[model samples]
Target: MSEPRPAYYAAHEGLVAEARPKPELWRLLVGLGLVAVVVTVLNLVLFSVVVGFGSNAVAEGFLTGSTPLAMIILLSSFGFVTLGVRMAVRRLQNRSMGSVLGSFRRSARQFWVVFRALLILGLVIAVLPPYDMGAPLTPNLGLSTWLMLLPLSLLAVLIQTSAEEVLFRGYIQQSLAARFQSPIIWMGLPSLLFALGHYAPAAAGDNAGLIALWSCMFGLLAADLTARSGTLGPAIALHFFNNLIALLLISLPDNLSGLALFILPYDMSDTDMVRGWLYVDFAVMIVGWLTARLALRR
Candidate 1:
């Protein structure tokens, strides 16, 4: 006798049968636009009220308004909203959220390996000639202040990174994968969106074009890793290490003892750093993709 179909599969089938047709892309886009507007307004109001008492209204307001703390709050709020919506939708279909999330969780060991890989790669870049350190390496905090804020900074990074991963690699990628069988749509769409999200930061000040190109390349690599791994582990690890390097270790000129950190032998004044870093980024992407494939092979 044939084995019985899994209850989860049966439930999925039943839901598909009764499920309403997918909404138009325009509708989805409008809903997301509204959510963005609401979040922006809420964030501004909170920041204005909270920091309004400070001496420098503009500086304090902006620091409070756009800092990682604000990002964490906004992202966590959205994460919870997404989680609730998914849970409700699953319940309506008699499905378990745990099962759904479980399907995407990766091995802890693999995750750690990816993190170590990124950390080492970043360190290597720091030590190599023509490093340029990319940006100014100035620590805003004194030793005492750093001690007090390090934990908070780390917590903020974790929250911010987790929020992005959940939104892009988890929710958006999975939804796209389910809706469209094409890997290009599942991976490319999120990658493009992620890149566009960095446009403002990347386009600000000097070397804007180079920064934007690198930012988009990073997004593409992260998206490819997510797609290949079928998990957010690699991308999260890479992003965490990327932020840590850019924020802490390499962010101090004095910290560059063993290697020259801020002076590049070759000029980086090129409009786009794409040609220079493209191969390197592509190599890292391949490593990430291959490592993920190898881990999943077992």
Candidate 2:
């Protein structure tokens, strides 16, 4: 098939629609509920295990609990959410998970090309001077532990980012596009939900609203990548690198810092510093997004 125009709704061109040729509007609502339930139950179970089998005392200290083993389990929870989306696809749309993934042959090649390019950029930045970075947050892991868990952390980030893209840009976007011809309905709706889902009041402190806006922008960019590439490859790669950097390379001094190489100098609760941090993030996100778009053109 000729490549469709890089419009928002065009991402659905390669998807399968055997069961729900016209997926009812209600189906998407129900699908979201199902995914929420699956993610919640899995998270609770995983948290319980990490807390040594439902210990409230353990739960209270979980945030400061920076064990390599605990980090691995928590990060691995991302994979189960992906499984939840796959199950939802089978039940609601009656389509294989591959349909949401786009054509494997194409997605696989694009995924790697984007990943390697982003990875190279990330390495270069890592070696650059700290410039305006304030005080460094306390290091959580020793050298030996960080080296040991780095592989696992990267895998978890990939699974986590891929899962988010599949749900927002893959299943949800394509499903709506199949029913609605307007790019507004197909693209805006999913991106809106994507931003809402990322709202973090306590974690982001006063900057929560800005983060949500950033997420919405990110959702739009990912949707654009999905349309332009005719697959989830570039979207996944973009998200994967974004998270890998935030969650693993340098993390806020908060709950999920177990696998990080460096920690922020300021507290997440510090309003002024976080605002500054967000400004830096905006620059990275914009550049990273453009890189992916340029890769698609190549």
Winning model by lDDT: 2
lDDT of 1 by residue, 132-152 (tens): 434434433455655555566
Query: Lowest summed-lDDT stretch of 10 residues in model 2?
Result: 1-10
Candidate 1 C-alpha error for residue 283, in Å: 7.5
Clashes of each: 0, 2
lDDT of 2: 0.78
Clashing pairs in 1: none
